[model samples]
Target: MKNQVSTIYKQAERFAEITKTAIITGNISRAKKCLALAEQLLITGSNETKIAISNVYLFSVSSFMELRHCSISNLFPKSLKAEYIKQINTSGV
Candidate 1:
């Protein structure tokens, strides 16, 4: 179980990086696809993994917010935004 979670977490990280690159390259569709995949993987993760991934997402959101002057909620779907908020609150992050 532990190894599986770790593997899933790593794959999600890779997808997140891909999403970042896609966004940097102005590939909005690709970025959205990768982001969705990353979110799906995150949903299946353990609570600890969810918290870790939330941190990553928070960092990405902050970077994008700084660059684009956009709201954090605009970066995620409604469900994902809620989940991330829950993780952040539960983790005290």
Candidate 2:
């Protein structure tokens, strides 16, 4: 379990590095690594952690989309919205 957690942390660090490179180089593919990593972490996490992570993800996505002038629906679907609401209600996230 410790190894697994460390592996996840390392993967997240790599994603952050890629994201930084993307920002510096203006590469869309590299930029997406951060979001991909975030989704992966939440997907493999415990229910409580997923709820907490999804809260942060939702906030970041919302903020970024608004900054880019894109609609939230462009990425977040009805299912994700429902899940987020349910998690928030149950976990107080």
Best by lDDT: 1
Name every residue pair that clashes in candidate 1: none
Q: Which candidate leads the pack in TM-score?
A: 1
Q: Write model 2 residue lDDT over 1-93, tens digit each, in one string.
A: 654534433544444455545645766565555555556657777775465546545454544555667544534445445554565577664
lDDT of 2 at 89: 78
Clashes within 3 Å, all models in order: 0, 0
lDDT string for model 1 (10-89, tens) is: 65455566677777787778866765755764688688666656666545544564577645565576556776677667
Q: How do all models score by TM-score?
A: 0.57, 0.45
Range of the 10 consecutive residues with the lowest summed lDDT in candidate 1: 3-12
Candidate 1, position 89, lDDT: 76
lDDT of each: 0.62, 0.53
By TM-score, how accurate is candidate 2?
0.45
